[model samples]
Target chain A: MDFWTLANALATGLLTGLVYGLSALGLSVIFGVIRIVNFAHGEIMVMGMFFALIMFRWLGLDPLLSIPLAAAILFVFGYFLQSTVISRVAHLPDHMQFLLLAALAVMIVNACLLIFGPDPQAINISYSFDSFDIGENLIIDKSRAYAAIAAVAISGLLLGFFKYSRTGKAIRACADNYLGAQVVGLKVSHLYALTFGIGAAVLGAAGCVLLLLIEVHPYLAPGYTLLAFVIVIIGGLGSMTGALVGGILIGMSEALAAIIFQPSMKSAFSFGLLILVLLLRPQGLMGKSVK
Target chain B: MMGLNLLADLTLRGRICLLIFLAILISLPFWSSSYIISVTTITLYLAILGQSWNLMLGFAGLLSLGHALFVGVSAYMAAYLFSVLGLPPVIGIFPAVALAVLIGMLIGYLGFRFSIGGVYFALLTIAFAELVRIMVDHMGLIGGTEGLFLQVTEADRQGFDLINLRGHPWMFYYLAMLLAFLTLAGCRTLLKSKLGYYWQAIRDDQDAAQALGINVFRYKMYAVMYSSGIAGVAGVFYAFYQNSLFPESVFGIERSIEISLGPIVGGVGSLFGPVLGAFILTPLGEGLTEFTDYLQSSGLIDPKLKLNGLKLLIWGLVVALIVLFKPAGIWPWLNEKLGFSRKEGE
Candidate 1:
């Protein structure tokens, strides 16, 4: 295709990948901390988007402004969800968790359906369609640009927190050694809730960022779930760098594949890439190889 | 201790119960309402598919969310054979199952050899299923996205050949029953064999099993192939019964989820759980569909209520509830409550 067209696709792909990375980061954090797959993660993220969308309409708050509120709400939900429901089932046999989470996903989606219905809803910002032309070769949508900025900012913030903060260190400590962490006086139960809260909050931010590009629909959750999953695995599970790199790789590959092959096969292509990456490096790109 | 005797006598009592159950099933078509019969037919199909999935997820402990791949592949194989080569379905089904088994073995080889299990393994399987689905959707040879419908003609009427395949729901129903029965019996037989012990040992402790000199990979592959073969047979029955094949319907994620639901909800790694789960959940699913349809028809609920997502919601909720409340599943919980413990070759 033309340079402008290719650039446009690449930029969009990058944005999409970054968003995927952010969400995958959330998923990885939860998986690393809790050891449950959190199959409802995608649905929860979608719920965040819908929640943000509703807030934007009701109070006329901007999507960006609504992110923290959405995050706070979901944080509480996640905290309770883990402490009450997920944690109890987490230590059970594998299939129990799978079924439990899958079921919870269904409930959330249905609840969304019951409340929101199935029609696609978009937050109507006058500037939603606004964009910028860079040089003679590229045009970037304003909303996507904002989303990309937010993604970078969020990723940086999360990275900084994880590396420097005491709670973040405790979280890492727990992931590395649960008994050791507890022995060192890190309250394990509260830490688990906090980890889940952080994960949910991150996903909430990602959801708001995602809503900038695509309209909200309940069915969209599963698709996002699979996408985040692919990115996380490709990037290396529970690795922040992996999530970032995996997201971008997926976004670019999906965009390029859509251009080269059929658009419907976007997911298929991502999955194929995931399998290839997994076969080559099961531990993921930035993580130590697990044998 | 008393309950233990009841459980001890269950293997004998269970057979008689199954025989009576079979007799009732055979007579169901005769006495049951047409609506119930149709529902039963679909349920039987689900039961067969669910049982097939149990062979992998339940026995081998490989959690698959792409089982619809086997089901869809088998359906497409049957359809392609019948429409293109004019092969009799009876013969077509055998090869379809064979092909599906081979495909399963390939996937199992890749998965086990490369050491992908848990969510990663589940994702790989999902990817394979999605790839096949996308290919089928675009491939115009089998009617593409619009789907393929088989023409029904008489076995012998003037110049037309009639296969007697159409409008014969009972035949397919009986076939499904036979397959389900065989799967149940086959699973029981397999579980009591050396291979079954190997699978359990591997599931319980992979490193330990390997340490004990078990070829963990080979046994896992065999489990995958067997489960896939059984799923293919279900697919064959599914194609013949529906007389139509669409990539979306056959190879959908919903189908994959439904297959796993039975074994998980019933009780993974246990006999009788999947069968009971199918019996319970299949009807519930049909009832939900009907309720949605009723709401749509009566104009009492939003038209969107009849849409695809609600069923997903229900299925997901059921799974979650089962996990939350009955982690070991109804049968396993009951078995435990009655004081049944693992015995050595009892």
Candidate 2:
């Protein structure tokens, strides 16, 4: 309501949105290239968080330092997942593919539950609860700021990779037109594995950053999966910039809705936005219209 | 006459198989344990849900992931009426069905009008279901997060009471069986109708269907309404049988997924697919839970190591294997292997 309070909410929303953007980037990329909605993306992200938690708790490493390791591990896991299991159903009907992903999601979530138990775990770095006052009544949490910074840096690196690397260009080409890319001698299946791996790596890094700010649990994947879906739909499916913008918009609207109503209703706002965007503009803000 | 014709259409082998299956089910209470009867009741309800879902997903090609919305809302509606208004479930179910149909049409309109098909349509359904679930969780009027319980009197629980829908386990079992039978018959009838052809056409190719002058939107809406209505019937049965309603249990995404699995595993478009799926899946699911409980009680497995995830893990593996192997589902494959003529209008 007040100026500084509003500004603080805005800042918090933007920072949180960056994390959401990072989380959604992999989903967008996978969808863009493979034309498959990876329902297990969120579970993969949670796996990353668990990986980070393991590094921090058992090995006495900072979660921030564990990001790359977690990402690398997830990259391999995702690559194999696509190459082995997902590729089997790559040519199946749309609903079958959807069911496969849904099954994978259930498997991963429950598998994590079996391994980790149902407890919520968080990484406790030195600055976990520390915050700094920027100006007037506006303050920023140290972990949130650090997470946001990491998200932005990772996103920038991804953008650079997509722009400059040959593999990235091949991925883009495959996403643009799979048949054309195939005609041009792009190993589409191999590229698909690589793209999925990249997506998983991004989600892994985002998960590490997320663990710095919030608790992680086996059940956490569905909510984030839904959130990423909302963000991607709003931003335009398969567009990097769209995911970032959409994530921020969702985060801001959620924050604003929390200010207006109850915090429990934040998801209502996001879902509402998703339905609206779906009905009014299925193409989304920055994506091409779906045929 | 229609029923006679349908019966007449069956081959001698089909008729004999049907008679034997019916005899088995009718005599179940006499020989099988109460646990098996209850599991059968659950399977029957799941069959209804799966068949209902198949009407839309398999025939109409509208992939809906939020079917729990219909079941949950209808159950809550009927439960609320029974508890607060003191209305019997038989009467309460009518309005619940109406509400479910109305909601189904609204969603169908929104989805089909915008040409939202495939996964996008599924997401739309999920969003609506989640939105409703969250809202219901906060609404204390209908028990909110704590849930509502139906009152079952001693007399009602002891014997058959058709009015209040409170009776022995056999009573619910019979009711569920009748419902499942009627639903199967109804689906067969629908599939034989012109609307069924239109649905299949639209499912096969919406653009091509449109070119053929089929009213795609209207037929699709009909599918949604009919499917939701059937699911609403299942919900009413659920409320009366379970005698309790929880937003999390009823409206959860897991519930939606569970409802869809029967149809997916059985055979999506086939008439007997849902029934076969439910028969296979429900017992397996219940058996896993019972096994885990037994293991825990017997100290065969560590109590500290929670096996809560084991059932779902197995379910996931089963579903994955099915999707990978028999994507057309088990019924059609079984039908082929058995050399039975395919069910009419599939």
Candidate 3:
């Protein structure tokens, strides 16, 4: 590929990667602290997208404008959902937790199905189809470019919060060692809720950004969720930077694979890459134990 | 007192229980219509799926979210062999089953080798299954997204004559029963073996099991292999019974969830739990749809209730309710409530 082509693909990959990073961050936050796999996280992201779509229709708001509202609404929903339902399951044996989470995921999907129906919803920003030229040869869709910037900015802000803030420190402490942190008088339950809220908020942001470039549907979240999970696993669990790196790698690989191979082969490539990475380094590219 | 003692006699109890079970099984065809028979047959296939999943997830404590991959792969293989090559299903089943096992080994190796445990491991399996489904959907060699269909004859229709593969509900019913029983027996035997102990040990704590000189990864892989093999057998039966193989129907996440539901609800890690769970849940699930259709036809409920998304709400609620209330499973809870715990000695 020529320099322009390579750069364009890389840019596209990075934009898609940012979305993956956002979603993975949500899951990583939950996994990092609670050590529970919120299998329904993807469904929740879908729900968030649905909310954003509703906002766009009812209030004539842009999807990007609905980001804060989506995050706030989903964050609250996630917090209560976890505190009331998921927390109970978290205390069960690990296998039971899996079963419970699967059950929850099913319930969420079913609920989404009931509420949203199967028809896909796409948001077309006026500028979504418009592209901007960078330097001499690189061209990028304005909406996609905006999405990439938003994802990076959101992720960067979250990382900054985690590194500097008080609640962030508590989250880090609880995730690092739940019991030890509890021993030091940290409110583990609150920390869990906080983590869940953040995760939900991150997904909310991803949902908004995604809806700008593409559409949202009840079933669509699982695809992104699974892909994001692959990214999280390959990125190394609980590592934000790893999630970013893994997302970019997978996004580029998928883009390249789709260019060279058939569209259907892309999922296979992503999944194959996930298995390969898991086999070689389960700890991930930037391997580190969460605890 | 003497009458009570007589009623409680061991021989009398055995005879009564056995007679009741046999009566239920035997009279099913007589009392129920052909439609019910087909339902039962489908339930039996699901029961096999549930039992297989329970063995791996419940007993071994290794979660696999992509079990439908096994069913789909085996079904497609069998379809290709039986239809394209003009091979009898009896002959085709072996290679399909073998291939399924090989795929299981590949998945297990990729997963357990790297020690991907818990939910991440399950997600890996789900991803793999979706990948397979996507691949199959796009590949035209096996009919692509249009799916593969087997030719049908009058003999293929459901009836008494068993010479041909068609129209024999009884064959499928009996085969499913036999397969379920065999699986139960096989699992029981494994549970009694040293390997079973190792599995339980590893499930409880892999590190501890390793410390005790057990090869944790090998045993876990064995569990996955056996489970996948059982799913393969069911896949072959399903292909013949349905006479079609669609990527969505055979290999989708929905199917995987359906398979896992039995084990989860019936009580994982128990011999008959998955069977019981499947019989209960599958019928209920099928019944719900039928009931919805009946209601819609009768104009009792809103015609708008026929919408697709509503059922998802009900399904999610049921699963969440089960998880919220009886996480150990309905069967175990029933057993406990009925004081059916095994005696200390045996």
lDDT of model 3 at position A3: 73
Clashing pairs in 3: A107-B316, A110-B312, A110-B313, A113-B309, A114-B309, B156-B166, B156-B167, B157-B167, B158-B167, B159-B167
Error of 3 at A88 (Å): 0.4
Candidate 1 runs further than 4 Å off = B1-16, B153-164, B289-315, B335-346
lDDT of 1 by residue, B174-246 (tens): 6677777777767777876899888888877899999999999999999988889989988877886787999
What ranking of all candidate models by TM-score puts the best one first?
Answer: 2, 3, 1
DockQ of 2: 0.76
Model 1 over residues A45-125: C-alpha lDDT tens digits?
999899888988899777888888888998998899888887887678766777777788778888888778889999878
* Number of clashing pairs per prediction, in order: 4, 0, 10
**How far is B33's C-alpha from truth in model 1 (Å)?**
0.9
For model 3, state the Cα shift of residue A112 in Å: 3.0
Worst lDDT 10-window in candidate 3 chain A: A94-103
Each candidate: RMSD:
3.9, 1.6, 3.9
lDDT of 3 by residue, A1-291 (tens): 577776887788778878778878888888877887767778788877888899888987888889899999889988887788789887786666766766677667767777777778787668978999988898888988888888889899999999999999999999777779989999889888878988888888888888877777677766776787888888988788888888888888887777678656777888888878877787889868532
Residue-level error in angstroms, candidate 1, position B344: 10
User: Per-prediction fnat values?
Assistant: 0.62, 0.72, 0.71
Best by lDDT: 2
Residue-level lDDT of model 2, residues B1-346, one tens digit each, is: 5455456646777677878998999999999999899889999999999999999988888888999999988999999998899898889999999989999999999998898878889999999999999899889999988988998877877889877788999999999998998888888788878988999999899899999999889999999999999999899899999998888899888898888889888888888889999999998888889888898889998877788799889988988999999988998898777744445554
Candidate models: Cα lDDT each? 0.81, 0.89, 0.79
